[model samples]
Target: MSESPSSSQQQPAVGADRPPALLVNNIEVIYDHVILVLKGVSLEVPEGGIVALLGANGAGKTTTLKAISNLLGAERGDVTKGSIEFSGERVDRMTPNDLVRRGVIQVMEGRHCFEHLTIEENLLTGSYTRSDGRAAILNDLDMVYGYFPQLKERRNAQAGYTSGGEQQMCVIGRALMSRPKMILLDEPSMGLAPQLVEGIFETVKRLNEEEGVSFLLAEQNTDMALKYAKYGYILENGRVVLDGAAAALRQNEDVKEFYLGISASGRKSYRDTKHYKRRKRWLA
Candidate 1:
């Protein structure tokens, strides 16, 4: 239910010259030969802007990210219809590695870092596809380190030994190594402290403001997600039920009640009391 702004009322007040960086049009996904996971979902991410896929659990957020990243295979999952285009190049049928090579990377949920490798080694793995990227990789590492300096200090330490926030940074740094035009970030704040979630969101902001990297992030952390994103689409029952500017969604009472959740205290409690103070020691 994306609110289509009329020609006279375009949001964020964009001009007519530039096209969207990523365009996913009426895509359908099915799994296990019979079950449908996505129902003709369509969306767009303008270049250098943050767009959020906002939803509760089981709302097709991850599925939408996976689908656009061309990680969906028929044997596993299939985009039965529609197309995904990046800068006007058709990409939905491509392989995951191919997509990465073409500068499309997905930082998956749960901070999928290489547990056995050192933080430096884990970050280096992100540039595996680049043969002579050592110098540029170092620069990128420096950039990521500058954003989360904790990673720089713990560069040579074992990735498995780091805390959740650091692991999330490593995963994001790994994706950035690919020099992606747009990164598909799935649940960057799924399981972390509130402060760390704020830090991660700030880093995402810094990236967009400084490097002009585009992002399409899916998150259940609606309060933070809408804050980080400029435009948002709310997913429900495997379909987009609401879409608008982040500021608009933020003020929408129904969105706050149903999707974003009424109690911000729950988010704060899980972050402050549980792992917030304890996890930062090792991470810092």
Candidate 2:
């Protein structure tokens, strides 16, 4: 009924058989030592697998990524409970630089390229964490350009002048230069054309299949995220409310009505439903 992966694309799925690239076990994050943001959230990203964390704004999606990448400390946020493991090692206490050295990198929301730097320079910055020679870095640069030819054309342009799509590609290209085993991407589709979004996701899929790079992407575009991610977790009020394989989630009734804006009931649309009790049940 299904075709097996060809030899070239036969990367093993993360499961009991193979350990995941990232494991977040019931992590709780607090901001300013009093305000709780993440409430016992947990998820997994399989080696070379693409996982999507889906939610609305303030649903703790970015907070969750920050927690895993050890970035919450900069914002006066801390993980007060639970642990995070990357590649079977404890990383909850490791600094962001330490985590990067260990093949974990986070591409923050807003495509944070140095506005003053040239496109090429911004990409070069990601290689600073590596002790590898310039030759290797150049090779990786070419590789990234191959995935994003637009960046190659505008290599000399200042990052601030580049289009949003190109800037997004530049940031991701920079991350790839680090030779990451996994990338924690946040809100990749924000403020981009639909076609540009598709192209970016396509590149991500190619990298996952060809380079065996894993991704844990946080996105609010449910339809697009589920289309690209192999598995997905939906967050509501700072906790995972639903999670499953992407295909199954795409077909789920509640997910359809609430997230995708596709109502399952024939009577009326989810937004058109005025009953709070009914909406609560659907979300539950």
Candidate 3:
């Protein structure tokens, strides 16, 4: 009932069976020497696959990204413990540029494009590491433009003048110019309209399918994230509480009720339904 991977498709997953694209082990992060933001979080992204980190606000999802990118210091939060391995190398202590050189690029929580620069200038900045410099930079720009043609038409415009959705495209395209193997997408659909959300997800899917770029996406748009990713990890209050195959998690009654609202059990748990409560409250 299923087709196994073809010979050409048999590379490695992020773990032992086949080395994953990225491996984030039991990591903890803290700020102010007391406030822990990430509590022993662990997840991985297999090569060319998408992994979603889902949770409510304040769930530590963004902190997890900052930890992986070593960008936590901007806010004084440090990766207090644990390690990150990317493509078989220990990466936790590396600088942001070092991580980018290692093919791990983060799009950041706010699509932080250079607003004062023209769209093309902002994109050229993404290829700062390339030896070919400006020429190769243009080639990468073409590739990015192919994905978001609207950006091409606005190439001469100041990035800040673009609409929110277009600005998001510029940020992602800027990251792509770095030619990364995997990307840490903070929240591509955060403030987008439903129509624009569909377009962004489609572009992400295309990039993954056509370019073999792996992704570790952290998003509150659970529906879209789950749609594109193969596996998922759910976080709450600084810890992961649920993780599994995306399809399995999507159908989980409790997950549907609590996260997606596809079930009517949101008011009560399977363990303490009315039937059980009537008979078992005293047991507690």
The predictions' CA RMSDs to the true structure, in order, are 9.4, 7.3, 7.9
lDDT: which is higher, 2 or 3? Answer: 2
Ten residues in sequence with the least summed lDDT for candidate 2? 275-284
Against the unseen true structure, what C-alpha lDDT does each candidate score?
0.81, 0.87, 0.82
Q: How big is the positional error of residue 18 in model 1, measured in Å on the Cα after superposition?
A: 3.2
- After TM-score superposition, the amount by which residue 149's alpha carbon in candidate 2 deviates from its true location, in angstroms, is 0.8
User: What is the lDDT ranking, best to worst?
Assistant: 2, 3, 1
lDDT of 2 at 207: 93
What is the C-alpha lDDT profile of model 2 across 205-242, one tens digit per residue?
A: 99999999999999999999999998998888778777
Candidate 1, residue 159: lDDT: 93
Q: What would the per-residue lDDT of candidate 1 be over residues 7-58, giving only the tens digit for each residue?
A: 2343321223557878787688998768899877777888888999988788
Give each model a TM-score: 0.85, 0.89, 0.87
Worst 10 residues of 3 by lDDT: 275-284
Error of 2 at 91 (Å): 0.2
Question: Which candidate model has the greater TM-score, 1 or 3?
Answer: 3
Task: Kindly provide the TM-score of model 3 when superposed on the true structure, using C-alpha atoms.
Answer: 0.87
Q: Is candidate 2 or candidate 3 better by TM-score?
A: 2
TM-score of 2: 0.89
